[model samples]
Target: MPLSEFDIIARYFAQATPGREDVVLGIGDDAALIDPPAGQQLVVAIDTLVAGVHFPLETDPYDIGWKALAVNLSDLAAMGAQPAWLTLALTLEHNDDDWLAAFSRGLADLAGEYGIQLVGGDTTRGPLTVTVQVAGYLPPGQALTRKGATPGDEIWVSGTLGDAALGLRIAQGQLQADDSVKATLCRRLNRPEPRLALGIALRDVASSCIDISDGLLADLGHLCAAADCGASLHCADLPLSSAARELMSADSGLGDLPLTGGDDYELCFTAAASRHGAIQSLATQLDCPLSCIGLVEAENDIHCHDPDGQIRNISGHGYRHFNESN
Candidate 1:
């Protein structure tokens, strides 16, 4: 017997919808009904992943599912929001039961971890693509934004950089790594963690925050543009995992990769210089490494500085979906 669209939804996607108090009506209904929590503003974001573009076409279905949701979660995290609901729009050329099951499991696992309930979604027969729109809640006037940084604010970032970009290189045969390092890097690339707790903690502490989806330079540029300011970033201060450091050590040319690499999903934020101690304490409390990499200044261009204060030229303003690359 051939599986129908209704059958696929009931068997796989329906189970992925976890119970939530906010969801008055979920799957199987014509539409989902959600009740917003009192005294909070909604934070909504949507992201789409297309096979062979955002990810490799042959990637595992499970990882693809996790990543599709994770990227959207990252956007919420950047805004200091708590994820409450999600809706998926999946397009595929064919209905493969095993693939759908595994994908649902992957999506459910992460959604459950974040307390996100899948309220509703759509499925279609087409090229494989996943689009997720996530809604989160945060106190009114407390949500972080790109427009908050001020001159003299300390710029900081959570976790390491360049691992996912390196992973992409390795996956595309542009670079090679040992089995262990490759595994670790690939996991970083496919299964990014959204820094929700950290975002909430920084809600009142940081002046501005953004999750690094595009390369550091590009995303920081966005933040800076929004704040109508510039930043002075030290090349030596970029946080890097041991693996990334090792890779860069082997080839000095790779040093810029961390600065320009994207998909890190780490929070890059700015706060007042006086809040340095508080930020350090928060980092310790969260057990997530946070580094102060630079200072926001009253200028319009991001100035990349070497340790000795010499300006360094950078290339490519990060990845653009519609821009052709040389």
Candidate 2:
């Protein structure tokens, strides 16, 4: 007998959903019931992943499941929220029991790690697609936003950049990575860590914050726009993973990968110059490298300067949904 929707949920997702105190009612309910903590704000974010668009059609089901949630978590992290619960909407062409099991395992594993509960979701027969909506909590006034930046504030980014972009190139056959660096690059592309802890720690310290879903230049542009300011980025100051550096060393043309590529889920933030020491200490505590790549300006545009102080032309404005069609 073909498994029905209710059967699939019971066999796979029901047991996978974690228990949460704040969740009054979870999976199997018509709708989830959540009780937000008093005085804390609820932060919610949603992201959709379509096969062959956000990820390759041939990508592993487990990776797809993990990434589908990770990306939404990244958004909540940007707002300095503690992940609490999530709802998933899965669209599939066929109900392969094995594939569902692996994907559920991946999703459950990440959810377990973050103490997030799967509350509710929908299942439908369609093209392969996954949409995850996540909710988190943060103190009343501490949720970070992109509008708090000020002129003269310093800009910093967490973790390294460009590896995922390079990995995508390698996957597309547009570029090749040596075998030595292939695994690391591909892992970065497949499994991005949401900087949830770092975001929370920076809640009161950072003047403004955003996650690097779009490339640095593009995402930074958003930050700038929200703050009604411009920015000056030092190209050489961009923190590049060893793998990305090695790949770029061989192909100078790939230098813009870090600036223009997307999928590196790091946090980019601004803070007053006085917080330099404090920021450094936070980095040490988190064990996540932080780079002071630029400064916020009063203007409303973003400019990149090479090591010698010459302005460089930006090739692309990050990934746009309709770019390929146009």
What lDDT tens digits, residue by residue, belong to model 1 across residues 202-305? 99899999999989999999999999999999988988888887778898778787788888899999999999999999999999999999999998999889
What are the RMSD figures for all models against the true structure?
Answer: 1.1, 1.1
Kindly list the per-residue Cα lDDT of model 2 for residues 180-230, writing each as its tens digit. Answer: 798888888988999999999998899999999879988999999998999
Which residue pairs clash in candidate 1?
Answer: none
Query: Best candidate, lDDT-wise?
Result: 2
Model 1, stretches more than 4 Å misplaced? none
What is the clash count for each candidate, in the order shown?
0, 0
Candidate 2 residues lying further than 4 Å off, grouped into runs, are: none
Worst 10 residues of 2 by lDDT: 317-326
Report lDDT per candidate: 0.90, 0.91
Query: Which window of ten consecutive residues has the lowest lDDT sum in model 1?
Result: 317-326
